[model samples]
Target: MLNNWVDQLNNTRAAAAPFGEANPKMLTAFRGLNAAQGSNGALDAKTRELIAIAVAVTTRCDGCIASHASAARQAGATEAEVSDALGTAIALNAGAAYVYSLRAMEAFGQMGK
Candidate 1:
Protein backbone atom coordinates (compact mmCIF):
# COMPACT_ATOMS: atom_id res chain seq x y z
CA MET A 1 0.00 0.00 0.00
CA LEU A 2 2.77 2.41 0.90
CA ASN A 3 4.69 1.77 -2.30
CA ASN A 4 1.49 2.08 -4.30
CA TRP A 5 0.86 5.47 -2.75
CA VAL A 6 4.42 6.50 -3.55
CA ASP A 7 4.08 5.61 -7.22
CA GLN A 8 0.77 7.43 -7.45
CA LEU A 9 2.28 10.58 -5.95
CA ASN A 10 5.27 10.55 -8.31
CA ASN A 11 2.91 10.29 -11.26
CA THR A 12 0.91 13.25 -9.99
CA ARG A 13 4.01 15.42 -9.64
CA ALA A 14 4.93 14.71 -13.24
CA ALA A 15 1.48 15.83 -14.32
CA ALA A 16 1.81 19.19 -12.53
CA ALA A 17 5.26 20.16 -13.74
CA PRO A 18 5.03 23.64 -15.25
CA PHE A 19 5.18 24.34 -18.92
CA GLY A 20 5.25 27.73 -20.67
CA GLU A 21 2.86 30.72 -21.06
CA ALA A 22 1.03 29.26 -24.03
CA ASN A 23 -1.28 27.17 -21.87
CA PRO A 24 -1.56 27.73 -18.13
CA LYS A 25 -5.08 26.34 -17.92
CA MET A 26 -4.06 23.41 -15.76
CA LEU A 27 -3.44 25.84 -12.90
CA THR A 28 -6.54 27.90 -13.72
CA ALA A 29 -9.20 25.25 -14.18
CA PHE A 30 -11.79 23.64 -11.92
CA ARG A 31 -9.10 21.12 -11.05
CA GLY A 32 -6.71 23.77 -9.67
CA LEU A 33 -9.50 25.41 -7.62
CA ASN A 34 -11.16 28.80 -8.15
CA ALA A 35 -9.47 30.54 -5.24
CA ALA A 36 -6.05 29.40 -6.41
CA GLN A 37 -6.79 30.01 -10.05
CA GLY A 38 -4.41 32.15 -12.10
CA SER A 39 -1.57 31.00 -9.94
CA ASN A 40 0.34 29.61 -12.87
CA GLY A 41 0.70 33.12 -14.16
CA ALA A 42 0.86 35.02 -10.90
CA LEU A 43 2.69 33.16 -8.17
CA ASP A 44 6.45 32.79 -8.01
CA ALA A 45 7.83 29.31 -8.56
CA LYS A 46 9.19 29.18 -5.02
CA THR A 47 5.86 30.07 -3.45
CA ARG A 48 4.12 27.41 -5.47
CA GLU A 49 6.63 24.83 -4.30
CA LEU A 50 6.04 25.72 -0.65
CA ILE A 51 2.28 25.51 -1.05
CA ALA A 52 2.71 22.13 -2.68
CA ILE A 53 4.63 20.98 0.38
CA ALA A 54 1.89 22.12 2.71
CA VAL A 55 -0.74 20.35 0.64
CA ALA A 56 1.29 17.13 0.65
CA VAL A 57 1.55 17.16 4.44
CA THR A 58 -2.11 18.00 4.94
CA THR A 59 -3.15 15.08 2.76
CA ARG A 60 -0.92 12.66 4.74
CA CYS A 61 0.58 11.72 1.43
CA ASP A 62 3.90 10.50 2.73
CA GLY A 63 5.57 10.20 -0.65
CA CYS A 64 4.26 13.54 -1.84
CA ILE A 65 5.23 15.13 1.47
CA ALA A 66 8.80 13.92 1.10
CA SER A 67 9.08 15.00 -2.50
CA HIS A 68 7.58 18.44 -2.06
CA ALA A 69 9.43 19.07 1.19
CA SER A 70 12.67 18.58 -0.70
CA ALA A 71 11.43 20.75 -3.52
CA ALA A 72 10.41 23.51 -1.11
CA ARG A 73 13.80 23.52 0.54
CA GLN A 74 15.51 23.69 -2.81
CA ALA A 75 13.23 26.59 -3.72
CA GLY A 76 14.38 28.51 -0.61
CA ALA A 77 11.96 27.58 2.17
CA THR A 78 13.85 27.78 5.47
CA GLU A 79 14.38 24.84 7.81
CA ALA A 80 12.30 26.56 10.49
CA GLU A 81 9.35 27.04 8.19
CA VAL A 82 9.48 23.47 6.96
CA SER A 83 9.80 22.08 10.48
CA ASP A 84 6.87 24.16 11.75
CA ALA A 85 4.63 23.08 8.91
CA LEU A 86 5.46 19.42 9.48
CA GLY A 87 5.01 19.81 13.25
CA THR A 88 1.52 21.17 12.76
CA ALA A 89 0.69 18.25 10.51
CA ILE A 90 1.93 15.79 13.11
CA ALA A 91 -0.09 17.44 15.90
CA LEU A 92 -3.30 17.47 13.87
CA ASN A 93 -2.92 13.83 12.84
CA ALA A 94 -2.28 12.73 16.42
CA GLY A 95 -5.20 14.74 17.76
CA ALA A 96 -7.61 13.24 15.27
CA ALA A 97 -6.45 9.69 15.96
CA TYR A 98 -6.67 10.20 19.72
CA VAL A 99 -10.23 11.46 19.56
CA TYR A 100 -11.36 8.71 17.25
CA SER A 101 -9.77 5.99 19.34
CA LEU A 102 -9.54 7.01 23.02
CA ARG A 103 -12.50 9.36 23.11
CA ALA A 104 -14.71 6.91 21.30
CA MET A 105 -13.74 4.12 23.65
CA GLU A 106 -14.43 6.34 26.68
CA ALA A 107 -17.85 7.21 25.32
CA PHE A 108 -18.58 3.57 24.65
CA GLY A 109 -17.68 2.64 28.21
CA GLN A 110 -20.05 5.27 29.59
CA MET A 111 -22.90 4.00 27.44
CA GLY A 112 -22.31 0.36 28.47
CA LYS A 113 -22.44 1.10 32.23
Candidate 2:
Protein backbone atom coordinates (compact mmCIF):
# COMPACT_ATOMS: atom_id res chain seq x y z
CA MET A 1 0.00 0.00 0.00
CA LEU A 2 2.21 2.76 1.28
CA ASN A 3 5.97 2.36 1.86
CA ASN A 4 7.02 -0.88 3.52
CA TRP A 5 5.72 -0.28 7.02
CA VAL A 6 8.96 -1.31 8.69
CA ASP A 7 10.82 1.22 6.59
CA GLN A 8 8.12 3.78 7.19
CA LEU A 9 8.28 3.15 10.92
CA ASN A 10 12.01 3.76 10.93
CA ASN A 11 11.52 6.81 8.75
CA THR A 12 8.85 8.15 11.05
CA ARG A 13 11.06 7.79 14.07
CA ALA A 14 13.96 9.40 12.25
CA ALA A 15 11.80 12.27 11.08
CA ALA A 16 10.52 12.89 14.59
CA ALA A 17 14.05 13.07 15.92
CA PRO A 18 14.51 16.71 14.92
CA PHE A 19 11.26 17.80 16.46
CA GLY A 20 11.90 15.79 19.61
CA GLU A 21 15.30 17.35 19.96
CA ALA A 22 13.95 20.85 19.53
CA ASN A 23 11.08 20.31 21.94
CA PRO A 24 12.02 17.72 24.46
CA LYS A 25 9.17 18.54 26.83
CA MET A 26 6.55 18.15 24.13
CA LEU A 27 8.11 14.88 23.04
CA THR A 28 8.18 13.63 26.61
CA ALA A 29 4.54 14.55 27.07
CA PHE A 30 3.59 12.75 23.88
CA ARG A 31 5.57 9.67 24.87
CA GLY A 32 3.94 9.74 28.27
CA LEU A 33 0.51 9.83 26.77
CA ASN A 34 1.38 7.03 24.38
CA ALA A 35 2.76 4.90 27.16
CA ALA A 36 -0.19 5.49 29.42
CA GLN A 37 -2.72 4.79 26.70
CA GLY A 38 -1.07 1.62 25.45
CA SER A 39 -0.46 0.02 28.83
CA ASN A 40 -2.64 -2.64 30.43
CA GLY A 41 -5.48 -0.49 31.60
CA ALA A 42 -9.14 -1.37 31.27
CA LEU A 43 -8.41 -2.11 27.62
CA ASP A 44 -5.58 -4.53 26.82
CA ALA A 45 -2.79 -3.80 24.38
CA LYS A 46 -4.33 -5.82 21.57
CA THR A 47 -7.68 -4.08 21.92
CA ARG A 48 -6.12 -0.64 22.18
CA GLU A 49 -4.01 -1.26 19.11
CA LEU A 50 -7.00 -2.57 17.19
CA ILE A 51 -8.95 0.54 18.11
CA ALA A 52 -5.99 2.66 17.10
CA ILE A 53 -5.81 0.90 13.78
CA ALA A 54 -9.50 1.57 13.17
CA VAL A 55 -9.04 5.21 14.08
CA ALA A 56 -6.03 5.44 11.80
CA VAL A 57 -8.06 4.09 8.94
CA THR A 58 -11.01 6.40 9.58
CA THR A 59 -8.71 9.42 9.82
CA ARG A 60 -6.91 8.46 6.58
CA CYS A 61 -3.53 8.75 8.19
CA ASP A 62 -0.90 6.70 6.40
CA GLY A 63 1.70 7.05 9.11
CA CYS A 64 -0.79 6.20 11.83
CA ILE A 65 -1.94 3.17 9.90
CA ALA A 66 1.59 1.93 9.53
CA SER A 67 2.55 2.47 13.13
CA HIS A 68 -0.63 1.22 14.72
CA ALA A 69 -0.94 -1.78 12.47
CA SER A 70 2.58 -2.84 13.36
CA ALA A 71 1.87 -2.28 17.03
CA ALA A 72 -1.35 -4.24 16.72
CA ARG A 73 0.50 -7.21 15.30
CA GLN A 74 3.11 -7.09 18.00
CA ALA A 75 0.37 -6.84 20.59
CA GLY A 76 -0.95 -10.22 19.42
CA ALA A 77 -3.79 -9.21 17.13
CA THR A 78 -4.43 -11.91 14.57
CA GLU A 79 -4.81 -11.08 10.92
CA ALA A 80 -8.48 -11.91 11.17
CA GLU A 81 -8.94 -9.44 14.01
CA VAL A 82 -7.14 -6.73 12.08
CA SER A 83 -9.25 -7.49 9.06
CA ASP A 84 -12.42 -7.20 11.07
CA ALA A 85 -11.33 -3.87 12.48
CA LEU A 86 -10.48 -2.62 9.02
CA GLY A 87 -13.84 -3.78 7.73
CA THR A 88 -15.55 -1.73 10.40
CA ALA A 89 -13.43 1.27 9.50
CA ILE A 90 -14.29 0.84 5.85
CA ALA A 91 -18.00 0.66 6.59
CA LEU A 92 -17.92 3.76 8.78
CA ASN A 93 -16.00 5.72 6.19
CA ALA A 94 -18.45 4.71 3.52
CA GLY A 95 -21.37 5.51 5.76
CA ALA A 96 -19.95 8.97 6.42
CA ALA A 97 -19.60 9.59 2.69
CA TYR A 98 -23.12 8.36 2.05
CA VAL A 99 -24.56 10.65 4.74
CA TYR A 100 -22.55 13.64 3.55
CA SER A 101 -23.86 13.14 0.02
CA LEU A 102 -27.32 13.85 1.35
CA ARG A 103 -26.07 17.27 2.48
CA ALA A 104 -24.95 17.98 -1.05
CA MET A 105 -28.37 16.99 -2.37
CA GLU A 106 -30.03 19.24 0.18
CA ALA A 107 -27.83 22.15 -0.88
CA PHE A 108 -28.64 21.55 -4.53
CA GLY A 109 -32.38 21.45 -3.83
CA GLN A 110 -32.24 24.71 -1.90
CA MET A 111 -30.16 26.46 -4.60
CA GLY A 112 -32.24 25.20 -7.57
CA LYS A 113 -34.85 27.64 -8.80
Candidate 3:
Protein backbone atom coordinates (compact mmCIF):
# COMPACT_ATOMS: atom_id res chain seq x y z
CA MET A 1 0.00 0.00 0.00
CA LEU A 2 1.22 3.51 -0.68
CA ASN A 3 0.26 4.59 2.80
CA ASN A 4 -1.59 3.48 5.90
CA TRP A 5 -4.61 5.48 4.85
CA VAL A 6 -6.51 4.84 8.05
CA ASP A 7 -3.60 6.08 10.11
CA GLN A 8 -3.13 9.03 7.83
CA LEU A 9 -6.77 10.01 8.24
CA ASN A 10 -6.51 9.72 11.99
CA ASN A 11 -3.29 11.69 12.06
CA THR A 12 -4.69 14.39 9.82
CA ARG A 13 -7.75 14.82 12.03
CA ALA A 14 -5.58 14.95 15.11
CA ALA A 15 -3.29 17.54 13.54
CA ALA A 16 -6.21 19.65 12.40
CA ALA A 17 -7.85 19.76 15.80
CA PRO A 18 -5.59 22.49 17.15
CA PHE A 19 -6.00 24.64 14.06
CA GLY A 20 -9.74 24.23 14.25
CA GLU A 21 -9.68 25.19 17.89
CA ALA A 22 -7.45 28.19 17.23
CA ASN A 23 -9.80 29.48 14.54
CA PRO A 24 -13.26 28.29 15.40
CA LYS A 25 -14.90 30.60 12.89
CA MET A 26 -12.83 29.27 10.02
CA LEU A 27 -13.53 25.73 11.12
CA THR A 28 -17.23 26.50 11.35
CA ALA A 29 -17.23 27.93 7.85
CA PHE A 30 -15.41 24.94 6.48
CA ARG A 31 -17.78 22.58 8.21
CA GLY A 32 -20.70 24.62 6.91
CA LEU A 33 -19.43 24.28 3.39
CA ASN A 34 -19.19 20.53 3.83
CA ALA A 35 -22.67 20.40 5.28
CA ALA A 36 -23.96 22.43 2.36
CA GLN A 37 -22.43 20.04 -0.07
CA GLY A 38 -23.85 17.11 1.80
CA SER A 39 -27.31 18.65 1.76
CA ASN A 40 -27.18 19.67 -1.90
CA GLY A 41 -28.44 16.19 -2.98
CA ALA A 42 -27.58 16.85 -6.60
CA LEU A 43 -24.87 14.20 -6.50
CA ASP A 44 -24.84 11.06 -4.45
CA ALA A 45 -22.22 10.44 -1.80
CA LYS A 46 -20.29 7.92 -3.88
CA THR A 47 -19.99 10.26 -6.85
CA ARG A 48 -18.91 13.12 -4.61
CA GLU A 49 -16.32 10.95 -2.93
CA LEU A 50 -15.01 9.77 -6.28
CA ILE A 51 -14.73 13.37 -7.49
CA ALA A 52 -12.98 14.28 -4.25
CA ILE A 53 -10.46 11.49 -4.82
CA ALA A 54 -9.72 12.74 -8.30
CA VAL A 55 -9.35 16.31 -7.07
CA ALA A 56 -7.11 15.10 -4.24
CA VAL A 57 -4.85 13.42 -6.77
CA THR A 58 -4.71 16.53 -8.94
CA THR A 59 -4.09 18.79 -5.95
CA ARG A 60 -1.52 16.36 -4.45
CA CYS A 61 -3.28 16.43 -1.12
CA ASP A 62 -2.43 13.32 0.87
CA GLY A 63 -4.94 14.06 3.62
CA CYS A 64 -7.80 14.50 1.14
CA ILE A 65 -6.80 11.29 -0.66
CA ALA A 66 -6.83 9.30 2.55
CA SER A 67 -10.15 10.74 3.69
CA HIS A 68 -11.86 10.47 0.33
CA ALA A 69 -10.50 7.01 -0.41
CA SER A 70 -12.04 5.75 2.78
CA ALA A 71 -15.27 7.57 2.02
CA ALA A 72 -15.29 6.17 -1.49
CA ARG A 73 -14.90 2.67 -0.13
CA GLN A 74 -17.67 3.22 2.36
CA ALA A 75 -19.86 4.62 -0.41
CA GLY A 76 -19.38 1.42 -2.43
CA ALA A 77 -16.90 2.69 -4.99
CA THR A 78 -15.18 -0.28 -6.60
CA GLU A 79 -11.43 -0.32 -7.10
CA ALA A 80 -11.98 -0.12 -10.83
CA GLU A 81 -14.11 2.99 -10.42
CA VAL A 82 -11.39 4.65 -8.34
CA SER A 83 -8.82 3.66 -10.96
CA ASP A 84 -10.98 5.21 -13.70
CA ALA A 85 -11.25 8.42 -11.71
CA LEU A 86 -7.48 8.45 -11.26
CA GLY A 87 -7.04 7.92 -14.98
CA THR A 88 -9.18 10.99 -15.58
CA ALA A 89 -7.00 12.94 -13.17
CA ILE A 90 -3.88 11.79 -14.99
CA ALA A 91 -5.34 12.83 -18.33
CA LEU A 92 -6.36 16.22 -16.96
CA ASN A 93 -2.90 16.82 -15.51
CA ALA A 94 -1.33 15.93 -18.84
CA GLY A 95 -3.74 18.22 -20.65
CA ALA A 96 -2.92 21.06 -18.25
CA ALA A 97 0.80 20.54 -18.85
CA TYR A 98 0.21 20.55 -22.59
CA VAL A 99 -1.69 23.83 -22.37
CA TYR A 100 1.01 25.37 -20.17
CA SER A 101 3.66 24.23 -22.66
CA LEU A 102 1.86 26.20 -25.36
CA ARG A 103 1.90 29.27 -23.15
CA ALA A 104 5.60 28.79 -22.48
CA MET A 105 6.26 28.58 -26.20
CA GLU A 106 4.26 31.75 -26.73
CA ALA A 107 6.34 33.56 -24.07
CA PHE A 108 9.55 32.25 -25.59
CA GLY A 109 8.50 33.47 -29.03
CA GLN A 110 7.60 36.89 -27.65
CA MET A 111 11.02 37.10 -25.93
CA GLY A 112 12.72 36.55 -29.31
CA LYS A 113 10.82 39.47 -30.95
Candidate 4:
Protein backbone atom coordinates (compact mmCIF):
# COMPACT_ATOMS: atom_id res chain seq x y z
CA MET A 1 0.00 0.00 0.00
CA LEU A 2 1.05 3.57 -0.60
CA ASN A 3 2.18 5.66 2.36
CA ASN A 4 -0.85 7.07 4.14
CA TRP A 5 -1.08 10.84 3.78
CA VAL A 6 -2.77 11.16 7.16
CA ASP A 7 0.17 9.37 8.70
CA GLN A 8 2.53 11.67 6.85
CA LEU A 9 0.65 14.66 8.21
CA ASN A 10 0.85 13.27 11.71
CA ASN A 11 4.58 12.74 11.32
CA THR A 12 5.10 16.25 10.00
CA ARG A 13 3.14 17.67 12.92
CA ALA A 14 5.26 15.69 15.33
CA ALA A 15 8.45 16.86 13.66
CA ALA A 16 7.29 20.46 13.62
CA ALA A 17 6.46 20.48 17.30
CA PRO A 18 9.99 21.37 18.33
CA PHE A 19 10.04 24.32 15.97
CA GLY A 20 6.66 25.46 17.15
CA GLU A 21 7.79 25.18 20.75
CA ALA A 22 10.93 27.14 20.06
CA ASN A 23 9.05 29.84 18.17
CA PRO A 24 6.02 30.62 20.25
CA LYS A 25 5.15 33.80 18.41
CA MET A 26 5.26 32.14 15.02
CA LEU A 27 3.21 29.27 16.31
CA THR A 28 0.64 31.59 17.82
CA ALA A 29 0.36 33.54 14.60
CA PHE A 30 -0.06 30.36 12.63
CA ARG A 31 -2.75 29.13 14.97
CA GLY A 32 -4.55 32.43 14.67
CA LEU A 33 -4.40 32.36 10.90
CA ASN A 34 -5.58 28.77 10.83
CA ALA A 35 -8.50 29.51 13.09
CA ALA A 36 -9.51 32.58 11.11
CA GLN A 37 -9.23 30.87 7.77
CA GLY A 38 -10.85 27.61 8.83
CA SER A 39 -13.94 29.01 10.43
CA ASN A 40 -17.21 28.31 8.66
CA GLY A 41 -19.33 31.43 8.35
CA ALA A 42 -21.02 32.18 5.04
CA LEU A 43 -19.25 29.29 3.36
CA ASP A 44 -19.70 25.77 4.67
CA ALA A 45 -16.81 23.62 5.82
CA LYS A 46 -17.00 21.42 2.75
CA THR A 47 -16.85 24.36 0.38
CA ARG A 48 -13.94 25.90 2.23
CA GLU A 49 -12.14 22.59 2.11
CA LEU A 50 -12.75 22.31 -1.62
CA ILE A 51 -11.22 25.76 -2.11
CA ALA A 52 -8.31 24.75 0.07
CA ILE A 53 -7.77 21.60 -1.92
CA ALA A 54 -7.73 23.57 -5.15
CA VAL A 55 -5.23 26.06 -3.76
CA ALA A 56 -3.09 23.22 -2.41
CA VAL A 57 -2.94 21.71 -5.85
CA THR A 58 -2.12 25.03 -7.45
CA THR A 59 0.65 25.64 -4.91
CA ARG A 60 1.86 22.03 -5.14
CA CYS A 61 1.79 21.42 -1.43
CA ASP A 62 1.47 17.75 -0.53
CA GLY A 63 0.80 18.40 3.12
CA CYS A 64 -1.95 20.91 2.39
CA ILE A 65 -3.52 18.51 -0.12
CA ALA A 66 -3.63 15.67 2.38
CA SER A 67 -4.87 17.81 5.23
CA HIS A 68 -7.56 19.58 3.23
CA ALA A 69 -8.63 16.44 1.39
CA SER A 70 -9.12 14.71 4.72
CA ALA A 71 -10.96 17.73 6.05
CA ALA A 72 -13.17 17.75 2.97
CA ARG A 73 -14.06 14.11 3.60
CA GLN A 74 -14.83 14.68 7.27
CA ALA A 75 -16.94 17.70 6.34
CA GLY A 76 -19.25 15.39 4.33
CA ALA A 77 -17.80 15.87 0.87
CA THR A 78 -18.51 12.87 -1.32
CA GLU A 79 -15.95 11.17 -3.53
CA ALA A 80 -17.66 12.56 -6.59
CA GLU A 81 -17.48 16.10 -5.25
CA VAL A 82 -13.83 15.67 -4.41
CA SER A 83 -13.18 14.28 -7.87
CA ASP A 84 -14.95 17.21 -9.46
CA ALA A 85 -13.00 19.69 -7.36
CA LEU A 86 -9.76 18.04 -8.39
CA GLY A 87 -10.85 18.20 -11.99
CA THR A 88 -11.24 21.92 -11.59
CA ALA A 89 -7.82 22.14 -10.02
CA ILE A 90 -6.31 20.21 -12.91
CA ALA A 91 -7.88 22.56 -15.44
CA LEU A 92 -6.67 25.63 -13.59
CA ASN A 93 -3.15 24.25 -13.34
CA ALA A 94 -3.08 23.56 -17.04
CA GLY A 95 -4.34 27.01 -17.88
CA ALA A 96 -1.78 28.65 -15.63
CA ALA A 97 0.99 26.60 -17.18
CA TYR A 98 -0.10 27.61 -20.66
CA VAL A 99 -0.19 31.27 -19.75
CA TYR A 100 3.20 31.14 -18.06
CA SER A 101 4.68 29.35 -21.03
CA LEU A 102 4.09 32.51 -23.03
CA ARG A 103 6.25 34.41 -20.52
CA ALA A 104 8.85 31.68 -20.73
CA MET A 105 8.93 31.97 -24.50
CA GLU A 106 9.30 35.74 -24.25
CA ALA A 107 12.21 35.35 -21.83
CA PHE A 108 13.88 32.90 -24.15
CA GLY A 109 13.57 35.28 -27.05
CA GLN A 110 14.99 38.17 -24.97
CA MET A 111 17.96 36.05 -23.91
CA GLY A 112 19.13 35.76 -27.54
CA LYS A 113 19.23 39.57 -28.01
Best candidate per TM-score, number?
3
The whole-model lDDT of each prediction reads: 0.69, 0.90, 0.94, 0.87
TM-score of each: 0.47, 0.84, 0.94, 0.86
lDDT tens readout by residue for model 2, 2-113: 3688887788889899999999999999989987874657888899899999999899787898899889999999999999999999999999999999999998999986
- Report residue 58 deviation for candidate 3 (angstroms): 0.2
- Name the TM-score of candidate 1: 0.47
Q: Which stretches in model 1 have alpha-carbon errors above 4 Å?
A: 1-10, 15-30, 34-55, 110-113
Off by over 4 Å in 2: 38-40, 111-113
Best model number under lDDT: 3
lDDT per residue, candidate 4, 75-102, as tens digits? 9998898889889999999998999999
**Residue range with the least summed lDDT across 10 consecutive positions in model 2:** 34-43
Query: 8, model 2: CA deviation in Å?
Result: 0.3
